[model samples]
Target chain A: MDLAPYLLLAGLEGLVQASVLMLTALGLSLVFGVMRVVNVAHGEFYMLGALIAWACGAYIPGPPVLGFVAGLLVAPLAVGALAWAADRAVLQKIGYNPEGTIVSTIGMLYILQQGALLTFGPDARAVDAPFYYTIRTPWFGYSSYKLFTVAVAILLVAGLWLLMRKSKVGLLMRATQFDRETALNFGIPVGKVYSAVFAIGAMMAAVAGVLVVPNQQAHYLMGTDPLLLSFVVVIVGGLGSIPGTIAAAVLIGLSDGLLSVFFSPTLAKIVSTLLVALVLIFRPEGLFTVKGRRA
Target chain B: MTKLQVEGLSAFYGQSQALRGLTLELSGGEVLCLLGRNGAGKTTALKAIMGTVPPSSGRLVLDGRELTGLPPQEIPRAGIGYVPQGRRLFTELTVWENLEIGLMTRKTGREALEHALELFPVLRERMQQRSGTLSGGEQTMLAMARAMCLNPSVIMLDEPTEGLMPSAIAGIREAVIRLRSEGVAILLVEQRVDAVLPVADRVAFMDHGEIKAELPIAEVRANPDLLHHYVGIAARPARPATC
Candidate 1:
């Protein structure tokens, strides 16, 4: 049997996984980079997005595509607003103390997980793809929607790069991240920047969740795997470096895909976990850390 | 005209008091040097007025506007610029971004950028360089230029020459003189009597968080013991007054 088709399928799968992982990890990186606070509840935001998308499909009257689009528009905004409120109410009150934020976000994670369980129940549910279009090849057929996801991910990443480089809001965020006291000295409203950054970070995860809902089932406990995977990506990429996050995501995502196809899913996860450990021991600053830049 | 007034300002860090009912006044186009020994609360006084350290009790009025209890971010918007000790530039950002952040609270746009560049012309050439990569003297210039970009009516300098060489010190003195000529009120904090004497119109001696004496530069010049008593420095021989 020719291995070309199988390898191509694995590569495509890796690209799709990498696309979602990058979006999710980028959100985690932004929050950690700017706020210096670990958000343990990040994956819950992704789970919430998927569940919200499922609800939109089930309840909204129209084609599956309409509900998917609605989910795309609504999930990020809703999740972002919730994240903002949480930051102001909990994170700010704690002064964003590193240890305190970790515990607080853990509490948040449980609350969100339990809330989803109570609302959506324990069963896993799936949503239809917005438009079922397939690209057929002599060996096998592929889902065009998966490719569409990759395209969307690239656009979002480009938009983020432009926002960081060219916009005033981006400048404020960068300043705040570099030196909070200096940022305040120049009237950057560091508090507002914190709230906005927290929200935007959660929104990134939510968008990824919405995008991946068609391919994966929405379950209350689904957050665990993505949460773990995202931590791996962010750490391997280096803390606070967006380009690093992207490169790491692709590295880990593709390796996981190929490993799973050739070996086993369990082995794939073990390899990723071991990769993080190796990176930690060898390159603690991350694979793409810039010299003199804070990690 | 009085540009800033601090009436009985006090501040604390935890249970320890840093400023104790400190009072001072700054007028347009004059440099008022706040002189004190280490830990005499000179930096705290500036921090209190800037709202970085919330004054425990007191009133801060800038040009007849009550500044007490305003957030730190709002202080710069109220026409008071601060070049904090250590030249706290956003080191990771380019010199231009640092200046751009200063311009955030002011609408002077390109004109303010031009003014700051004029004050420190070397900064114009180093606009795109990350502030952290600059030499110490250049960092000081960038810090001052960033503050100047606010087009402030009043500006405060907290030990701007603390770690600088003599040439850099001269650059700072010249910049202070130029700022005074532009009619911007300056509240300068300095330990070096020579550095202060050239640009300051008056000096306020602070010890243990309280202002002990306020005198004209000539008064401090005549009373050598005052410097020895408050700041612990022997008075230098009289030279031609520069201000």
Candidate 2:
């Protein structure tokens, strides 16, 4: 069997995986980096987004494109609202204590998972692509929607980078992250910023869900793999470093995709797990982060 | 006009009380220094006014507006700027970024930035540098400048001259004087009586979380035993009698 075409296909698939992983991991990184809250329920937010997209796709009375677009628009807003409420009612009430948030988010994870299971039922569902088109490569044809996914992910990440670097809200978030007391002394409402950041983080995960639902089935438990992979990405990227998260996501995503294609999926998982362990032991601060940078 | 008035303010940290009926007042354009030994509750009194420590009892009013029980973030919005004891600049951020954060409450723009730079020209030269890398004196200037960015009517400075060289202390003294002349009321807490005596309009001696004595600058200057009694420092040569 000629492996060259297969390799090319694998590399493209890797790009797709890397793109989605970057979006998901960036959300996780931002939440942890700024709020110092380990949102164990992050993966469930991804799952909720996919389920919301599936529902929107099914119920919206429109063409497939319009339905998919509605799903895309609705899922993130819904997830963001849910996350914001959770932050205010639960996390803030708990004082955002590190250990407490971890436990609370775990409870949230189970609640979200079980809620989806009861409402959406046990079946996996898929949404139709907004546009039906294909691109002819040198050796084969490829789904143009997948390419669109990659492009959209890139654009969203770029937008996020700009927001963090330039906007007033971004400035407030950074200041709060650096020193909550000092930020408060400066009259920046730390609690409100925390809720906003939590919401934004969940919205990013939901976006990844919306983008990927057309290609993958939306199941109640589908968030597990992405959650695991995102943790790997964040850990290897450095906990709070945005650039580090992106770089780590690409590295892990490409390796996972290529390894799964060339070898077995099980072997790919094992290798990625091993990579995380090695990184944790050898360079705990992550590959891209400088020493003493806030984790 | 009285810019700030504290009456019978008391605060407790957990089980132990840190402040006991601390009472003081500051007029617009006046500098009131709180001088005391460590654990004398001078810092606690400042924290209570800033709302960082919740006062158990008493009323705090600024410009005739009640300030008790307001959240710490809201206190700054009520025309009080705090330069905390440690000069807590956001170390990771650039000098400009630190100033930008400081500008949140006042909404002052480029002009405020320029003003801060003019006050500490070294900041202009180090705009892009990370604040953690600045020298101790430069950090002190940045802290004061950051607080001043709020355009606050009343500024509270806690231990601003701690660990600073004579030149840095002199720089701070000059800044405080300028702010006073511009009609900005100041509540300064200092252990160094010599550094504050020249600029303070009145001095309140605190011991055991209560004011032991309140005297005018001239009175404290003439009575060396008062300084020795409250602040525990031998009376030093007073600033030239120009002012």
Per-candidate TM-score against the hidden true structure: 0.96, 0.93
Per-residue lDDT over B37-121 for candidate 2, one digit per residue giving the tens place of the 0 to 100 score: 9999998998888877889999989999988888888888888889999899888888888898888777877776777678788
Let me know the TM-score candidate 1 reaches against the reference structure.
0.96
Q: Where does the lowest 10-residue lDDT sum fall in candidate 1 chain A?
A: A286-295
The model with the greatest lDDT is 1
Q: Tell me the TM-score of chain B in each candidate.
A: 0.96, 0.96
- Docking tier of model 1: it is medium
The lDDT values for all models are: 0.91, 0.90
Error of 1 at B241 (Å): 6.8
- lDDT (Cα, tens digit) per residue for candidate 2, span A1-295: 4899998888888889999999999999999999999889999999998899899889988888887888788989999999999999999999999999999999999999999999999999988988989999788999999989999999999999888878889888888888888888899999999999999999999999989999999999999999999999999999989999999988988888899899988987898889889999999899889987752
DockQ each candidate and list the results.
0.74, 0.71
The digit string of per-residue lDDT tens for model 1 on A1-295 reads 5999889988999999999999999999999999999899999999999999999998998999999999999999999999999999999999999999999999999999999999999999899999989899999999999999999999998888888778999999999998888787888798999999999999989999999999999999988898899999999999989999999999998998998998988998999999899989999888888866853
**Deviation in Å, model 1, residue B226 alpha carbon:** 2.8
lDDT of 2 at B106: 72
Residue pairs in collision within model 2:
none
* Residue A261 in model 1: lDDT: 92
**Model 1 global lDDT (CA atoms, 0 to 1):** 0.91
Screening candidate 1 with a backbone cut-off below 3 angstroms (N, C-alpha, C), the clashing residue pairs are none
